[model samples]
Target: MDKERLPRWGWLLAGLFVAALVANLLNLFVLVPTVFPEEYRAVTVITTMSPVLIYVGVWYDEHRQHYWEQSGAHIAGDVLFVVTGAALGSAIVLVAIIDFGIPAFLREVLAMGAGFLMSWGLFWWRNPDVYADESAR
Candidate 1:
């Protein structure tokens, strides 16, 4: 893939990651306190899991068609992408908050955006044909 086109996927993935981060943040900061109120145990569980479900669903939707090969290696690589991206993104946010005194919200947004870009780049590099239609750009 051309270096110039790489930014397109970077931005796209960053946007998705930020959306996931925002959903999770909203659940923690607002929905849990106001909408779900801790008094209801089932509501709490639902609220806690909703953001994760949303993120996974969105991620799968974004890649499902491109990665429909169903090969073991493809599945394993996709899983690795999720695990590594989440781990690295969390670490980045934690370090920024603790060491730089950045707000958690800002750190999370930045970390997830960067994580998605990096992870997507790796994924795209591994599967160049996924975005073979450069002419569409």
Candidate 2:
């Protein structure tokens, strides 16, 4: 990865985090407050889905080049990454709700954190050379 590309990747990660934060905020402040308590489950599903969707979209766009080179493995890895991230995030939310009795806002925050960590981990695993200097090329 070029030094120049590093900033782009950083910005992309930052944007994903910010988007997750905003989704959680909206879920906590607007959706939950305005909707019926019964619909809270639906709100939770939507908030959880948003980050995974963003991660998939960004990952696909960034790694499209590697798609053709290793189509089967790459696609499978992508699917696994999304599914694992979603499961991890959902588990965090469930645990927070059931075990900790944490508030909605804090639960959202934990979900976002889980999503961020999963996304970063997968991204790093997929792009191990991300920090390599590219000036020679």
Candidate 3:
């Protein structure tokens, strides 16, 4: 369907998913590792970026007029999504910190896979059609 026809809340979730995936990957792989080796400082970046991503996602959702009125569930879901992303990034760091338990290539793969699965599950569970249908009933 076209942009106008897309459900407002669905679009909002979609945008958040995309932003979280991009930001988490870029920061975890490229930015953090490049700037601050594998110390506590690097893990700090991974954990801290989660809330930052959520805030930025919310700000973009507001400016973009994506979702319907903000709801408690939406905010909760956003937090969940960000936490999942942060955990994935942190897992990679753990692998590196523990003597490269996970190979370099596998770390990137795991991060992307986790991001996709988390986003997909959250979006599926909170689908806008289900919300609308329930309200109509």
Instruction: Give me the runs in candidate 3 sitting further than 4 Å from their true place.
Output: 1-41, 61-63, 101-137
Residue 86 miss distance in model 2 (angstroms)? 3.0
lDDT at 60, model 3: 43
lDDT scores in order: 0.51, 0.55, 0.53
Q: For residues 43-90, what per-residue lDDT tens digits would candidate 1 score against the true structure?
A: 222222233433343344444354566698876775576446554554
The window of 10 residues in a row where model 2 has the poorest summed lDDT is 38-47
Q: On TM-score, who's better, 2 or 3?
A: 2
lDDT of 2 by residue, 106-132 (tens): 665666566556655665577545423
- On a 0 to 1 TM-score scale, where does candidate 2 land against the true structure? 0.45
TM-score per prediction, in order, is 0.46, 0.45, 0.37
Clashing pairs in 3: none
TM-score leader: 1
Q: Give the Cα error of residue 93 in candidate 2, in Å.
A: 5.5
Residue-level lDDT tens digits of model 3 in 1-137: 35565655666666556655775676677767787554333344344444543444344443434444669788677667656656565566455545666665555555545444554445445544332433464
Which candidate would rank higher by TM-score, 1 or 3? 1
Work out candidate 1's RMSD over C-alphas: 10.5
Residue 51 miss distance in model 2 (angstroms): 7.2
